[model samples]
Target: MDEEYDVIVLGTGLKECILSGLLSVDGLKVLHMDRNDYYGGESTSLSLVQLWKRFRSNDKPPELLGSSREYNVDMIPKFMMANGTLVRVLIRTGVTKYLNFKAVDGSFVYNNGKIYKVPATDVEALKSTLMGLFEKRRARKFFIYVQDYEDDDPKSHEGLDLNKVTTRDVISKYGLEDNTVDFIGHALALHRDDSYLDEPAIYTVKRMKLYAESLARFQGGSPYIYPLYGLGELPQGFARLSAVYGGTYMLNKPECKVEFDTDGKAYGVTSEGETAKCKKVVCDPSYLPDKVKKVGRVARAICIMSHPIPNTNDSHSVQIILPQKQLGRRSDMYVFCCSYAHNVAPKGKYIAFVSTEAETDHPETELKPGIDLLGPVDETFFDIYDRYEPANHDEHDNCFISTSYDPTTHFESTVQDVISMYKKITGKELDLSVDLSAASAAGEDA
Candidate 1:
């Protein structure tokens, strides 16, 4: 227990495991510990029996739903953007070698009591049914302008500086309808709310470009991808990467407590009356509650069904974003669905999730707009969890705490936390210069 290391990671969640892997690869002696016996701490994929045990207590799942072992339900369901930072991290760390990824099937947005495929590209905008003939031409021109705009090319700026203008200004210049702007901002740009309209247009423009490039990468139905088994495979893969780089791991270690020195800086971790010395500590919010502040609550409904979500072009896996304007809410609601084609369920079963930032006390009522879209759910579970962010700086306390997962069904914000923590710890930004096309090919082959 007296063995000293460079960093002591106190949880095996996706964020912690990723840091463990990256730090170990940098030749830092790392010690990873978890109280649970499993690899993923909070973001684990569970079997049908485990899911029932967590939610239903002694109630057993219906046998007609299929064998318990055939299901892998994710606790926090999210998909990875094909060209997002998370995928770049995987490629840079070579974790892609440990997992296989399949493109998601569809991406849709809800507007005016109906769902429509988001017009992400110029062609899609021209053919979109969400707008009128004249509106479609306007949207197509807007899409072309965005597609051709380049940060370094002055001629492509279209006489407006995105950095100086707000997203609202750009949309207004094109005279796009309110509904067209809704899907482009909320669905394509992946904004959780309409707040981005008041912010700099450059941020939204870059995000939209990322979505288009990601969609073009696979030339598939959507811009996102999911692992073969589930997201639970992610932490395990990074754990293995850490192990290969000489990092030590301990699971089922009870009472794992962070030890602070007299100066209030994290020094080590103690478990079972034995302390492992370290210079710094990295952990999830649960390990050091006092260091984090509750920012919001996320309400989620997990559903089991016999078919794919209706009106999604029969997509076996899909992501649907319900803009707040359409639902008369302050934030967007997300619907994610996956079926046997993704290997997360049995031959004829599907798993779907509806989630959003909880704005009211009644989660069921808040999520009804998305729930109503699902035709028939065989079984469902609803929950609300508090979201937290670090109130203390890691540089001052040497305790790097990861934020709680948000309601969005994507890894963009999650990876931003990780990248931010990495910079704080190492005093440098992570360099991710890997070839994404090659990495995607390798992951597909795996």
Candidate 2:
């Protein structure tokens, strides 16, 4: 008989890519696969690259040594200062080189069609700009809590009671300023789910601290990094690297079923009725805890286009558009207009994304009426295109739209809803289209 392979890897997410790449490079015959057509699980990329050129300045992060020597990982350092505290951003594992992203510093205000920058690094300067709404009054509360909170595991916040709290209650309890509260609320929408107005104050505080900490690690007084190309390039680069290491990559397979042995051990997976054997499988543990746990909640959408919109700022990377709660939509529903990083669009063209969450078991009803989030994507394009004034500004053509609905707590749908919100406001579409499909697997590692 042929020698048994050393390992069989499941999923092509970044962790799988990284692990399989390392193992294969070490001479193990690793077979990597994902139910989806694309790679890079959460950290994936999209194309055609016309989105990032508007706001990005082709800046690079300050050079810094990385902790990972086994892989040639080049990272930049960033510094973050909040509430008079200083923290650094040490290593951004997969950041693009052309797109520049930095923490808001000193004071920046948009007025009279120009950006006004106030130069200061102290608490007073930040108070005038990056002030904390809840922390200012309850600074001691946050600091004391964090010092006592577990700091080892990245997801340890889940263990704390604070995670159960909502963002709204935290703000009301602390009497935080509306401006500060809005800023953080928007940021939370960017990171986690935005379906609830109330959230754990602890998470908000910790996240800010984490961002500040990342920034502090950088040499630049500024606490942000911009990608040289589009943000997708970073993940794409990783995917390319994984392919170079002899790992198998399959996109658009849409895994439909997972098979298990009589002993209750996962043994194989089927995509569109095609079966494949597996000796060892690794997946995000929460995705499938047991043989019986087959379903979950996930939502995603994509909107692409070629035209620029009015009232959009070229310098603003992330844009927020929200209808009042009185507008009848859930308070949780708001539009996020995320700007593309460098090269996200081609010359004279740009693309935007919209992400949202549609409750499982109610996909059709979950999505509302009169809300053509998919087809009328172009209207949003012109709204944002007319807002910015640039010497070389030009409009491009419309592309395509796509969506993904995963029943397994997949976060991509959330990202897609956000991109869709942008399209609603900008009327632009994306260049590529893909969906995420998941399957149950046995004992696995994230």
Q: What's the TM-score of every candidate structure?
A: 0.98, 0.46
Given candidate 1, what's the lDDT at residue 122? 93
lDDT of predicted model 2: 0.35
How close is each model in CA RMSD to the real structure? 1.1, 16.4
lDDT of 2 at 381: 19
Candidates in order have lDDT scores of 0.92, 0.35
Best by TM-score: 1
By summed lDDT, which 10 consecutive residues of candidate 2 come out lowest? 437-446
lDDT (tens digit, per residue) of candidate 1 on 289-379:
9899999999999999999888899999999999999888899999999878878899999999999999988888988999999999999
Tens-place lDDT per residue, model 2, 1-446, is 12233444445543345445444444555555566666555444433221122123343211221111111111110111321111011011121221233322121222222222221222423343234444454533433444345656556454445667775765566565554444444332223334446555565656555434433433333233333333333335445544566655566667534455775554555667666665544443222333123232333223343433233334322222232221233322222222323334333333333323333344334333212322235322111110111111012101111122222111223334434422432345522221101000100000
Q: How many residue pairs clash in each candidate?
A: 0, 95
Clashing pairs in 1: none
Give residue 156's error in model 1 in angstroms: 0.5
